[model samples]
Target: LGMRPPTPAHPTPQYKGRARDFLYAGAEAGVMVLNAGADVMRFAPSLVVEEADIHEGMQRFAQAVGKVVA
Candidate 1:
């Protein structure tokens, strides 16, 4: 969460490059979808995904973005 602050996918006046990169990283990790536009991230976990799985998924999500932002 502290890795990088979230920003708008479609900034009103201008689009930001870093925000778009963050969205792409999240999607590549299979952790969540950047659906709700570039500014929002959505986690669509199935009911079958256990609590442990959720935790692991989040960890993976963080790792994926960490590489990009770090």
Candidate 2:
């Protein structure tokens, strides 16, 4: 499990939002995997985010999974 600071230095608003979404998505996927008896979550920092970037990451992660599964 990797924990990153919420905000990145000198990030544009759009990129920051994307990062938050990705982070949220990744976390949700990780939880689902864990519940399904998976061993690990290979989480990494997005290299940027805003102070309000928590739940957005999970949403982004869920979107990614939808695409791949579709």
Candidate 3:
């Protein structure tokens, strides 16, 4: 199946001060160190997903984070 972009992309409003700098710095570090693809932090909604699928996605996300940090 062909890949499709997520609908209704969430917008992260701009921040200011040290927090803004930190966010950018963290993103830069993540990109440099992890070389993660675009979907690394994706949040996909279930079109008709059951509770089990939601749970599985959560578990998978947790596992991915663990692997990245480990």
User: Cα lDDT of all candidates, in order?
Assistant: 0.60, 0.42, 0.38
Ranking by lDDT: 1, 2, 3
**Every model: Cα RMSD to truth:** 7.9, 13.4, 9.9
Ranking by TM-score, best first? 1, 3, 2
Off by over 4 Å in 3: 1-40
User: Candidate 1 or 2, higher TM-score?
Assistant: 1
Worst 10 residues of 1 by lDDT: 1-10
Per-residue CA lDDT of model 2 for 1-70, tens digit only, reads 2556433222244343244343344555652211211222334345554535546654665576455435
Q: What is the lDDT of residue 27 in candidate 3?
A: 47
What TM-score does model 2 achieve against the real structure?
0.31
Give the 10-residue window scoring lowest on summed lDDT in candidate 3: 31-40
User: Where does candidate 1 stray beyond 4 Å?
Assistant: 1-20
lDDT of 3 at 54: 52
Which structure is stronger by TM-score: 1 or 3?
1
